[model samples]
Target: MIADSEIELHASRLMVMQAAWKHERGEDIRHESSICKVFVAEAVNRIIDRAVQMCGALGVSADTPLEHFYREARAFRIYDGPSEVHRMVIARDVLRSGNRS
Candidate 1:
């Protein structure tokens, strides 16, 4: 699970960076932005959780870096915009595109 989450998070970061560069070059990348946001937001939590699970008691300890990551990842889900909203936006865009084609 940890490996999968790491892979997913990396992919999301790459997507976001690419989108940002595209926007800097005067391209519209709203869909990529939302997709990356949702992907990273969800994957970060999963990675932390898997790490926590692997660490056992130490994972939940107040002094551990894993715990801090866990908290941050959980809170990140709600920052800027929630995962639910981003997913909805992506779904709506997909539906619109499907209808067009």
Candidate 2:
């Protein structure tokens, strides 16, 4: 889980960078932005969940900020737009572009 989370974190960072690059080039980045948002939100939640699992009960205790972080991370999925909605946006874009194999 930890390894997967780390890999996803790097991938998500790259996705954001690519989206930002597109935006800088005066390209419409709505699709890329939605993809980045969804990917990063899910990645953050997964990473925080793994941290909580690894720490066991201590993860939720006030002794650590894991619980607080977990709640905030979860809220990320709903901020701006929910993951499901962003997913719909991505799917619509892909289908409209006929980008599937």
Candidate 3:
């Protein structure tokens, strides 16, 4: 599970980097960046949640490092523009694109 989560995290980072590279080249990638950040944050949150749950009550208790991990997992949803905001951005982008075709 750890290995799989690590792979997912890495993939998300790669996607964000790729989108940034395209933006640097003058591509209209505002939506891409938003989507990438949302996905990456959500993925990392899921991984951290799993790690915490696997540790049992220690996950939320202040006696263990899992508590800190749990805090970070909960924060990820709000730190990067929030999941709902990103979803809205993606939907708007898709709708605008469709109208142009």
TM-score of each: 0.83, 0.93, 0.78
Against the true structure, candidate 1 reaches a TM-score of 0.83
**For residues 3-99, what per-residue lDDT tens digits would candidate 1 score against the true structure?**
7876887888788899889899998788888887888888788888988998899899985799988877798889879989998988999898985
The stretch of ten residues in a row with the least summed lDDT in candidate 2 is 92-101
| lDDT: worst 10-residue window of model 3 | 92-101
Between candidates 1 and 2, the TM-score winner: 2
Candidate 2, residue 53: how far the Cα is off, in Å: 0.5
Q: Rank the candidates by TM-score, best first.
A: 2, 1, 3
- Give the per-residue lDDT of model 2 (tens digit) for 1-101: 78888899899989999989989999999999898899899999999999999999999898999999998899999989999999998998899999931
lDDT of 3 by residue, 1-101 (tens): 78878888899989988898988999888778787878888898888777777778877788887778767677777876888998898888889888521
Off by over 4 Å in 2: none
For candidate 2, the lDDT comes to 0.91
| Deviating ranges (above 4 Å) for candidate 1 | 99-101
Ranking by lDDT: 2, 1, 3
TM-score of 2: 0.93
lDDT to native, each model? 0.83, 0.91, 0.81
